[model samples]
Target: SAVISQKPSRDICQRGTSLTIQCQVDSQVTMMFWYRQQPGQSLTLIATANQGSEATYESGFVIDKFPISRPNLTFSTLTVSNLSPEDSSIYLCSVAGSLSYEQYFGPGTRLTVT
Candidate 1:
């Protein structure tokens, strides 16, 4: 099993501002993914961060809006740019496991744009 940790368990930000959330993993992983869980909605993959390469973001998430960086196998960061109330959601860090098809999540960085 793998474990992940995220900073700023929760925060309230103003519109047009930005917040960068950090993620750290306990062990090396082949794939590290970022997800967003909005209120009353399901989890959506924001991007995939692999070591030594540019992060691959999912549709609807552009590099300008949600820039991601994976400096090494163990650490990554996600920045929410030009924030809006619509961006208020639970941003999570996840890592793919060896056996399980599911990924493990951090407690999450809950962002509230007011």
Candidate 2:
């Protein structure tokens, strides 16, 4: 199983600002993912960040808006750039466990835009 932890559990930011959140894993996992969960909703895939490759973002998302970096097998970071009121959400980092198909997620960084 994979254990993931993310930094900055919560933050209140102003408009036009940016925030970078870090994720750390206890084991060397193959794939790491970033997700966003809006208020009262399920998680949505933001991008897939492999250990040595560029992150593949989902449709409706762009690299300039959400830049991701996975420097090694067990560490990654996600930056939310050019923030706005709509950007307020719970950002999470997740990784699929070694055995099961289920993905384990970090506690998430709750951001509020003001």
Candidate 3:
């Protein structure tokens, strides 16, 4: 299994601004995913960052809006562009357990847009 870590556990941003969240894993994992959860909702996958290649974003999300970078197996970054009130949520970094098929999540970066 891999242990994931995220930076800037929380932040407050103004509308139209941007914030970047960083994720790090203890060991190389098969997959890494980025997710977001609203105040009272479940996690929504934002994208899959492939090492050395462009990221694959989910529907309703785009590269221009949520740019991601995976420099290597143990590190990745996600930038939230042009923030809005609706963007306020808990952003998480996750890794798929190699053999257990379990998923481990970072504490999360809670953003409050105003």
Candidate 4:
């Protein structure tokens, strides 16, 4: 099992300002994923960051809006750019386990854009 921790557990940000969230894993991981959970909605995958390659953003998410960095196997960062009220959501970091279907998640970063 992997232990994941996210920084800035919760924050209140003004509209149009961006926030960068950090995710750290206790052990080295090959697959790290970023997700967003909007109010009253299910988790949506933002991107997948591998250790050596560029992150792959999901259909609705773009690199311009959500830039992800995977500097090494144990750390990654996701920055939400040009924030807006609708961007307020809980951002979560997750890593895949040995099993294909198994995943461990970090305590989410809750962002409230006012």
TM-scores for every candidate against the unseen true structure: 0.95, 0.96, 0.95, 0.98
Model 3 weakest 10-residue run by lDDT: 95-104
Stretches off by above 4 angstroms in model 2 are none
- Give the alpha carbon lDDT tens digit for every residue of 7-96 in model 3: 999999999999999999989875789999999999999998879888999999999999998989899999999999999999999988
| Candidate 3 segments exceeding 4 Å error | none
Local accuracy of candidate 4 as per-residue lDDT tens digits, 1-114: 998999989999998889999999999999999999999999999999999999999999999999999999999999998899999999999999999689999999999999
Backbone clashes in model 1, listed as residue pairs: none
For this target, which candidate reaches the highest lDDT against the unseen true structure? Answer: 4
Better of 3 and 4 by TM-score: 4
lDDT of all the models against the reference? 0.93, 0.93, 0.92, 0.96
Positional deviation of 92 in candidate 3, in angstroms? 0.4
Q: Report model 2's TM-score to 2 decimal places.
A: 0.96
Ranking by lDDT: 4, 2, 1, 3
- Model 2's alpha-carbon lDDT is 0.93
Show pairs that collide, candidate 4.
Answer: none
User: How many steric clashes between backbone atoms does each model show?
Assistant: 0, 0, 0, 0
Candidate 1, residues 29-79, lDDT tens digits: the string is 878889999999999999999889989989898999999999988899999
Candidate 4 segments whose C-alpha is farther than 4 A from its true place: none
Candidate 2 lDDT tens digits, 3-63: 7888999999999999999999999988999999999999999999998899999999999
